[model samples]
Target: MYLDDPNRKLLEIDTDTRQGPVIFRWLTLGMEYLIGVILVALIVSVSCNVVGRALFNNSLPWADELARMLFVWLVFIGAAAAFSRYEHIAVDALVRRLPLRIAHMLYLLQHLIITGLMVVMIWGGYQVLSRSSGRSAIMDVPLSFISLSLVLCVIFIAVVSIWRMWVSLNVIRHPEREH
Candidate 1:
C-alpha cells in the first residue's frame, strides 16, 4: 500500500537555511559510500579467508579479526545512512488511521523521542571512543579508530533527526528534486 502524502516534512527540515541541506546531503552521501565500500571489502575479505582456509589450508591471520571489526562498523554506518532516508522501521499502522493533523502530531512526537535517543547515542559513543583511544588488543590498530564509527554514525543520525525536526516546523523548504 502507498500513502498519498508528499512527505516533504523530512526534506523541508533538511533544506532549511540553504546551506543546511547541501551539507547534510553531502555528509549522508559520503557516509553511505564509505559504508558501502567498507561492507564490500569486508565481504570479499571474509570470502577469501574462508576459501583459502578450506582450499589452500592457509588463512589470512588478520582477515577474521578485521572482518569482525568491519561488521560493527557496517551496522552503525548502515544505520546512519538509512536514517537519512527515513528508512528506519516504525510502527505507523495505528497512527496512520488517525486524522491527518493528529497523525502528524503523533509522528512529530515519535521523531522527537528518536532525536533524543540519537543525541544520547552520540554523547555516549564519544565517551566510549575517548576511553578506548590507546586500547587495542587485536591487529594493533587503535581501538578508538575502529570505535570512531560510533561517533561518526551517531553524529550523522543526530544531524538528520534535527533536520527532520526543522522541516516539520516549516523552518526549511524541501528541495525541488528528490535525492
Candidate 2:
C-alpha cells in the first residue's frame, strides 16, 4: 500500500498544505507503480520479439499482440493517473487570461465534462465487454480482458475527478484549507 516515501519533506517545503486526500494519493502512487510494471513488460516483450526473430529465426506469436494490448492499457491508465496529478494536456491560454474566479469556474466545468465523458466510456466499455465475451481471440485471451482495462481506467478517473471536485468545492468555500 505504501508505494514509496513520496518525499513528504519536499511536498511540505513546496506547498502550504501539508496533507492530501489519502485515496487520491494512494491511487496515483499505485498507478505509477503499474506504469513501471507495464514498461518492464514492454521492454521484455520487445526484446524477446526481436531476439526470437533475428537470432532464432522464429518470433513469438503472442509477443506483439500482448505488447500492443499492454500498451493500450498503459496509455489509458497513465492518462487517468496524470489527470490526478493535473498533468494532462490542455489549452489553458485563455483560462490564464481570465480572473481567478472565472478561471476556477472554467476548471470546474472542465472537470465536470471529463467526469461525464469517463462515465460514457465506462458504459460503452461494459457493452463491448458483454458483446465480445467468448468471441475475441488475441493470443488466446478474450477481448473482455482488454475491455476491462477501459472500465478500470474510467472508474479511476471518475473517482479521482469526483474527489478533486469535492476538494475544489471545499477550497472555494474555505480558501485557507487547500491541499
Candidate 3:
C-alpha cells in the first residue's frame, strides 16, 4: 500500500523543522545534499569522458569507471531518499478504496513488510561485502565499498519504514487527529 493521494508532493514527508522530528529533518537534508552532489558528479564525469573521446581521440578510462561507481551510489542513495519520503512506485488503489481504518492497517502492514525486506537486504549486503575482495580496474577501490551502498540504502529505508509504521499506528489509534 502507498499513501492515498497521488497528487500530493512526492517528497512531502514531515520534514518541517518546527513540527517534525529533528533527526528526520537532518536525514532528509543530508540525503538531498548527497544526491545533488552525486548527480552533478555523474553528469560532469560523463560529459568530460564524451568530450575527451570526441575532441582528443583519447578517453579517460577512469572516467567511465568513476561514473559507473557514482551511478551505483546515486541509485542506492536516491532510493533511500525516496523511501524516506514514500515516493517509491506503489499500487495503492485497493487500499484507497477501503475504509480509512482498514486502509491504514494495510499501510502499516506494508511498512512492516518493507522493513523486513530491507533488513534482509542489509544482512545479504553485509555478507557480500565481507566476501568481496576485488578492486575496480581503474579506481582500485575495493568491491566491498560498492557493496556497502546496499547496506547503507537498506539501513536508511528500514529506519524510514519503521517510523512510517509507527506513524500509521498512531493514525489508526486516533482517527480524528491529523498525523
lDDT of each: 0.70, 0.70, 0.79
In the range 88-145, model 1's lDDT, one tens digit per residue, is 7766567657654455555566568877988888788888877775745558888887
Output the number of the lDDT-best candidate.
Answer: 3
Off by over 4 Å in 2: 1-19, 135-138, 174-179
Candidate 2, residues 1-179: lDDT per residue as tens digits?
74322211111111124245666677777888899999899989989999999999999988998898889889988887776666656666676666544555565676688789999998998889889867335477887887888898898888766665665555456545434
Residue-wise C-alpha lDDT for candidate 3, range 6-26, written one tens digit per residue: 322222365653334568767
TM-scores vs. true structure, each candidate: 0.78, 0.80, 0.87
Question: Cα lDDT for residue 40, model 1?
Answer: 91
Q: Each prediction's Cα RMSD?
A: 5.0, 6.4, 3.4
